[model samples]
Target: MSNETPLPLVMLRAVVSGGCDVTPPQRPLTPSGRN
Candidate 1:
């Protein structure tokens, strides 16, 4: 379980960081348009 846990944790962190960087710029555009 310990070994399996680290693998997914690393992948999730990578994906989360990537998504955050990509999403933040795009998010403002949509909300600004609505506002």
Candidate 2:
């Protein structure tokens, strides 16, 4: 078996992590925009 993650999953993880980093600081200022 190959020990490798699919490309889509890798991209998804990157996006999620980046979103978490960006969202927190923006959440307070735009509480109504981000849910």
lDDT of 1 by residue, 1-35 (tens): 76677877989999999987788676776664446
RMSD of each: 4.3, 5.0
Question: What pairs collide in candidate 2?
Answer: none
How far is 29's C-alpha from truth in model 2 (Å)? 4.8
- Can you give the lDDT of residue 4 in candidate 2? 93
Minimal lDDT window, size 10, model 1: 26-35
How many steric overlaps does candidate 1 have? Answer: 0
Error of 1 at 16 (Å): 0.6
**TM-score of every model?**
0.50, 0.56
